[model samples]
Target: MKNSRGSLVRPHPLPGSASRPVVTPLSPSVVYASDTPDALDDQYEGRVFGYTYSREGHPNGDVVAARLDEMEGASGGIVTGSGMSAVSAVLLGLLKQGDHVLGGNQLYGRSLRMMAEDLPRLGIDTSLADPCDVDAMRAAIRPETKMILVEVVSNPTLRVADIAGIAALAKESGALLVIDNTFTTPRAFRPFDHGADIVIHSVTKLLAGHSDVMLGYAVARDPALNDRLRVFGVTAGLTASPFDCWLAERGMLSFDLRFDRSQETAARLADHLAGLDGVKRVLYPMRADHPDHARAVQLLGDQGCNMVSFELTGGRASANAFTKAADGLSFAPTLGDVGTTLSHPASSSHRALTPDRRAALGISEGFFRVSVGLEDPDALLQIMTDAVAAARAAEG
Candidate 1:
């Protein structure tokens, strides 16, 4: 319920949110038959009733949201304009003043900012811990803790969180486990299957597939939470547009195929980087030397995602040079697109994070994240390989 003016009001419900919502179309779009001059009065006719406001729910918006919910096998899901909006909607709905949010230190930068500064201003407190250290996470929880936020595969550095272990801890503490499954999309990981209460995504990256539309969603396993979130979404006016949702729906069709090829590219790259002369570290979640490879294999099973992170032999400058020299891959600020994207986390995605915080997270000047695309594997390899070589020569 939204408290505004003088009274609290219930938000309009979307179809498929329940077993069935009596969705009547907006004033009913007319379907004309060759012989009919008047509208049909039959039950099969679409309803004239539709969303009075987009904030309540758009028709296409609900359709794609339902698609995502079904995909996640969630009780329900809500789509938002951007990934950060999805995070904001959930955090704002569930957290209040004096509440605590525990996030993994390796979280997406935007998320860290939202929890650290945005939520705190509303009286909620936030903390972060090394996700690789289950003991650290256990120690971080307090009586006021309401949520544990983590990425399925962490940002900048692709550290894999122990989802099952953390979910258990969240349950014990009576806290909700919210997992950002953007990097590892449903193609790679299903957070709910591992015990997460909520799964979040930046559809602009993977789910949308094309890097064309910016969208996000939060999927809930709990029916009550799903209903409450929908109300909050409608009342607060934080909702996704119909067009973006439509684009996302279109993108979902090719998800499995695109990621399959991208993963193959990522594996080859991770392997190649691990042995390369100028590479100091490769942080692919599936790599054996990664801090969470065992858990990744256990959690991800066979499908490891397309994102790969590595440190340049030199530092930030070298990383920039390499990314600039790359031909096939665009140096965009996002991931999970159909084409490859490279970004310098310290300056781009995680820019909101303080220098000290970024340093602590190991998003160094030398660190670069590569989002493998659908480009030919050999071409991508050559482009990336050449980028590194150029950076090394320039630095030398």
Candidate 2:
């Protein structure tokens, strides 16, 4: 017997618990109770598995991390608030002052900016080089190089890196190779299979399938390095909310189905666009004309990727017209949505780069990146064909 308020605060416990539900219950509690001080100490000290605080350790994050670990074939992993946060945790955790990073120039623009601009401010030097050119990457590696960061498939331009070749380089140089596998999820390319020390993913995209959740994670092949990343991730306050983690896990339930459909559609879309009059060059990893076609084949098999980029004959005006005429198609700044979407590099992902830099990377004003979705291939093809006509009409 207790006062009303007291009774309300501490409700009667259900003798035990119901049978486990199929869907995981979201535990969004910021803090959890401990039976005793020694128990909590043990939890914090990693003597046993348990949650103390959401920011430090939690059930939801652990579940998703474990799932990703199994998917990426790693012993351990940690989920962060976002993809960039995951990258930040890895760089800050692994490297110290005076260490150097040799990063791919064609990585996601934000990632490249972080390595080239932000890392240097922390006394960590970075050199940007073409990851496709293994010889150039080897030459660029310095004695102090502590990390070799690259993407499985570069963003926007769709360049495919030689993961095994570069991994060998990293090993020879005694540098840890960190591969960003956002574009090529574990279903397509598991970096661990090719000697990658660490694999990172923006689970917001393909892993989650839908575009609703914002989550990311880093999986480490070595347990020691994974533990270090977890410590830094917790210290840096990069942990994600339980709700987001739960949603991401739910999204992954249908990952294989969504990935396979979108990838198949993207291959067809690339072919359709290539034959259009207003298109200059279509950038799809599997395309025979693509410079990295051979490497892409060896790495990704027949399924290249769901992302496709192509240049319009009329540049920005043509792109503007195409989007305007292409009714029902979303012009999202982000990628990996269930529905087909378009992104303009000049305005979205690579907008921060100088004009010369954009040109050097072949991200022209006319360049449009398509995040192929679960839409009907024939319907998407028709929409694209009409849009190309509109683009040409505007150019004239």
Which residue pairs of candidate 2 clash? none
TM-score of each: 0.86, 0.97
Query: Candidate 2 lDDT, tens digit per residue, 164-249?
Result: 88999999999999999999998899898899999999999989878889898997888899889998998899999899999999
Regions of candidate 1 where Cα sits further than 4 Å from its true position? 1-50, 354-356
Clashes of each: 6, 0
Tens-digit lDDT string for candidate 1 (1-396): 655744536333344654543532332212222223233333124444334446766776778788787778775798888888888878998788999999998787778778778887889999989777878999999999999999877887887787777988999999999998888888777788888989888888887889778888887888888877888887877777677777777788888888898999899988887877777889887778888778888988877789899888887678778978898678888888888888888779887778887778887788889888888888877887888887787666
| Candidate maximizing TM-score | 2
Per-model C-alpha lDDT, please? Answer: 0.81, 0.91
Location of the lowest summed lDDT over 10 successive residues in candidate 2: 9-18
Best by lDDT: 2
